[model samples]
Target: MFKYAKRLQYPINIKKKDINMAKQLITQYGGIYYKKDIKK
Candidate 1:
């Protein structure tokens, strides 16, 4: 669904809890941080 949404925008205004969860996942996977609409 999200992958197909070409017009999506970001800085997304995500909740603090969601941001924390995302940080955890990124750390676990050794991934770099980026905005939702930006490709790594």
Candidate 2:
């Protein structure tokens, strides 16, 4: 469990890979993070 984080976690090695896939993963993870942030 996490209390708080200073940075947003993005996919590993995404910088050298496909931008599209990176975006998809970011959005998916970001949504969950966003919801949790609001709940807090």
Which candidate has the top score in TM-score? 2
TM-score of each: 0.34, 0.36
lDDT agreement of model 1 with the native: 0.59
Residues 1-40 of candidate 2 have per-residue lDDT tens digits of 8797577576544347675675567668786564444332
Model 2 regions more than 4 Å off: 1-16, 32-40
Least accurate stretch of 10 residues (summed lDDT) in model 1? Answer: 31-40
Q: RMSD, each candidate, Å?
A: 9.0, 9.0
Taking the tens digit of each residue's C-alpha lDDT, what string does model 1 give over 1-40? 3566566565566555666676677666665544453354
Each candidate's number of clashing pairs is 0, 0
> Which candidate has the top score in lDDT?
2
Clashing residue pairs, backbone N/CA/C < 3 A, model 2: none
